[model samples]
Target: MITRFEELDWQSTPIGDLTLRRRTEPAVGQEIYEVKLGDEYLMSSLFTVAEEELADLGLAAVAGDGLSVLVGGLGLGYTAVAVLQDARVTSLTVIDRLGAVIGWHERNLLPVSAELVDDARTTLVEDDFFAVMRSAPVEGRGGYSAILLDVDHSPRHQLDPTHADLYDAAGLRALDRHLAAEGIFALWSDDPPDDDFMIELNAVFDDAVAHVVDFENAVTGGMSSNTVYVARSRGTGSASLDSTPAHADKDA
Candidate 1:
């Protein structure tokens, strides 16, 4: 008999305890993977629609080929793998604070591990995404065509306090320096569109918009949605969605 739940790996890091587990979802009767930091549920294999859109929509806004991209988070390798799907992307750099997560992809512990590991364009960097951005421009590096971020749950709530500044005006201005003149920045959020964050983006980028991504939630047997904010265009508006998550007012 197969066990319903299994713990794959666990580790102690500077942030907190990290854990990767597999559980058989009774509703689907299939293996589902999950990652958690301490007691906080980070990500699960059940819903990845929005994670994928972060790459699709972000890269879609880029006007040309030979795109240099940067992905801020590498959880489950979904976002990175999604980025590789675009043939126009020439380079991809993924920064994650946790080495354990990178190891998961390198060791083929996750479902999308093979895709990320085999891709030559993918560079998985173990570092603080925020700290790297602070000096990325001053380091004499070429700007990325698109910077896709999915690290935090939302602008209002951060996994760590250090990320809060990145959503502000000065922080955004610093990040703007790392972008090409036409480069775009896309962010994934677990909450609805934040007006204040939009203001911050518009302050630095030419244009910005928040897109609501709706997908089926098998766990809740209902629809769930996530917000993807894309900047560096020529307009501003929130792509509204009529649906909402089944849980609390905070979608995250």
Candidate 2:
């Protein structure tokens, strides 16, 4: 069989150049979708276990129906799609800094795009997530039931150096304002758990914890892990789910 690789689209954004591509994996005989910023790989369809887990673990912490959510990144739409899988979710707003990434989904270039586009509960917004968090309340909803983020590689390892501030105490506080009382804030980190980030998260939110998600790395044929940090807004309600395992780190 011939290995097929194609560049689906590319664009120049305020931060950097973005590219979307699709290729066939020889080992799995599966078509994989990927997004890149300059020379860095942003996301890939081949490894989405952590992305999906971000949504699942985030929503599991929240308790209620008619939930509203804000997804910080729209890579392959895995996280957003996972959020929609829960019947309690009523609205989903996915924000991506790169317009080209959004266009790929709109054009049906991604495997999960059609499902994401057709869902009445889903809305795609093109904007810097950190900027939006610092600026205004999203959609004037006052706050959402959950905020799931998967934009940067990690708090310590950001795709853009400017994003470094977002991992700080002030930045976490700003993000907290966008959440409803006791609302959930979950982030995906490519690196293992960081204790210092957890301390900062705890200072901002009422309770914060991290979960380590392990998956098989297709390329290396080895186990790799990602961190999912979930925190609750300062409020009176109690968390419905138990804390994640002890091995998990908080944020980055």
Candidate 3:
């Protein structure tokens, strides 16, 4: 039998000390992967539903073919891998603040690493996602059909203070500028939807909806839920204007 636990890799990033771990989940009788910052968990392979949904729901909302995508966080590579599942997506640019995370994918430290890095369409960038969105348009980096953000714990509860601005009207506008004429933005939040965030989304994008993504939790035993906020500006709206969305500080 294999060892129950193993520490895969550890690296110091700008945000904090990052660690990648693999363990045999005895309860489920399966190997599991995880990413951590110091003692805090950033991502776990056991729970990937919302992260995958962030790509699925966001891409589904987009209206056109030949989609070019931009993903703000490269967690365990679930979101990026899910984005590639769509045949319409021609290109995918995934940016993470920590180069260490990107390195894991290239090194195949994570299960989805090979699929994510081997794909011809995927490009991984080591940079602050918030900073990239701010200068995305100005840098002449071209536009994207969809922008998926899963970096922060939530709009209200950012891992770092610098990420707070991206949830506001001004920051979202900057993000919108990087999108093609008809584009959408999807965000993953560990917390339930919020009304105040709906106010912010309505102010920027034409149509937005909050989805309560329900998933089972091995650690918690009971069912847990996440929020996926999808907003699109496609001339008119497909989602009703009355829906509300919100966020917090728990790392999903």
The list of candidate 2 runs beyond 4 A from truth reads 136-139, 236-252
Query: At residue 61, what lDDT does model 1 achieve?
Result: 91
Tens digits of per-residue lDDT, candidate 1, 176-248, equal: 6667777899999999999999998888777699999999988789989999999993222111111212222
Candidate 2 local distance difference test against the native: 0.84
Report the C-alpha lDDT of model 3 over 192-234, residue by residue, as the tens digit: 9989998999898977899999998876778999999999865
TM-score of each: 0.90, 0.90, 0.90
Q: For residues 118-203, could you state the per-residue lDDT of candidate 2 as single tens digits?
A: 99999998777877665445355647899999988888988778778779877777677678898999999999999999988888
Q: Residue 230 in model 1: shift from native, Å?
A: 0.2
List where candidate 3 sits over 4 angstroms from the true fold. 1-3, 234-252
Q: List the global CA lDDT of all models.
A: 0.84, 0.84, 0.85
Residue pairs with backbone atoms closer than 3 Å in model 3 (clashes): 193-246, 194-245, 194-246
Cα RMSD, each candidate: 8.9, 7.6, 6.6
